[model samples]
Target: MTEYSEISARLAALPDAELTTVLQAATVGRPAFWAVRAALDEMAGVGHIAPGGDVSPTTESVQTHDQASGGGASGQVGAASAVPVVPVHPAGIPASPAAGGYSSGGVPTFESVRDKVEQRFGTAQGMGELDRQTPAGRSADEQWEAREKAARERLDQIRKSVHDNDNP
Candidate 1:
């Protein structure tokens, strides 16, 4: 059977409780979540849902699904799908064919940024996230500012510890 047909059958076979579990675990804006959502919409559109339920596709839902799936009727997939299948170095930087490819020259590549940030601020950021959870009256921006402050403080403490260790 075709992949879509297999997916449809699998979707059909999924018990309501299991389907609900899957839905609960699915994160919004993720491809897998969008795929399941689209499949459900398609199934409902084709009269697969029980008669008592509201299975009719709303214009908003249809538009959302179409956008998420890269708008088949628009003659091209959405911009998200337009990204190259293979990871490539940013423009003007030729990628190395060697394992763990390097960008042109010793200049920092996009991939290295995450590792550097984590190495520098991971502990502090973790503490900051926890700190932001408290002090409930603050707005999101304020909370973020507080988190940054906490991270800075933690980083300072780390620097002091490292300096002390080196001097002693």
Candidate 2:
């Protein structure tokens, strides 16, 4: 049997509740959802199922502007009418021209490049200044010296303990 006939038979054999459950469980984007939806649509006589399980509008439902207005006897839709037209532009760029009649001409400036780099890698300025800031209540150099003195005192205490242990 043809694949389409097999699908129709399988769908027909399913109980209404089981069919509904299968429909509910099917994901939107996958082939299973499209196949089930197409079968259901065909069984209901709502529309014709095209190849690849795409549902096309019924002859009675689809009417072009020309046909609606009784203008064209050919019954053919124009290329422009078949699909929609959308305007696309780069992000953050205006679709219309500016007030001064000046355009960036799609050229990258040093300032623009630097701003993009800063946005991606974080701000390059003020980092060194942040690193050089003194600690609270004391300069960094003084804090380093204090730490060094403590370490030396601890080393001296360890050495004395070792020397006393050796003698004992």
Candidate 3:
């Protein structure tokens, strides 16, 4: 009935690949993530921290030594507290994924490649009418193979032309 619950439900329904994407997205631009992680250590009876060790944040209840004095402590505590060493995927890498599990010009995972394909072309359902025009039971895969061969042949011709131009 609540917003969190709704989000949780929707997240639950998604397949694993989509879930991975959402989890990856949530970590971005969220400095608070590191603070909570530090707070958890204190909750497990870690009263004192090193001069400058990692500190996680917890709910408002997990107060530090300075908090009892006044409202200054309150300023520090909240949901977005815990911070991690590496931001999971911090820099150089991108937030919006291209394809697959592989990042940074790497080959995409199968699902990521499929997702890209669907985004560029229409969905399977959207292509259904066109597919029906093909012989029944002749899958999309079959058509793709034929098309790929044709593309390769065309690419070979282009390559030969370029090679001849440079050499002659």
lDDT of 2 at 155: 100
Candidates sorted by TM-score, descending order?
Answer: 2, 3, 1
**What TM-score does structure 2 among the candidates reach?**
0.22
Better of 1 and 2 by TM-score: 2
Q: Which is the better candidate, 1 or 3, if ranked by TM-score?
A: 3
Per-model C-alpha lDDT, please? 0.53, 0.50, 0.53
| Residues 1-168, model 2: lDDT tens digits | 699999888989985545544563463345434435434433323223446743553343322221245434456642113322122234554444421222334344566676688776654456545655646424776788899999999999999999999995
Q: Which one wins by lDDT: 1 or 2?
A: 1
Cα RMSD, model 3: 20.9
Error of 3 at 154 (Å): 69
Q: How far is candidate 2 from the true structure (C-alpha RMSD, Å)?
A: 23.5
Q: What is the Å distance of residue 105 in model 1 from its true position? A: 42
Listed in order, each prediction's TM-score against the native is 0.20, 0.22, 0.21
TM-score of 3: 0.21
Query: Residue 130 of candidate 1: its Cα lDDT?
Result: 79
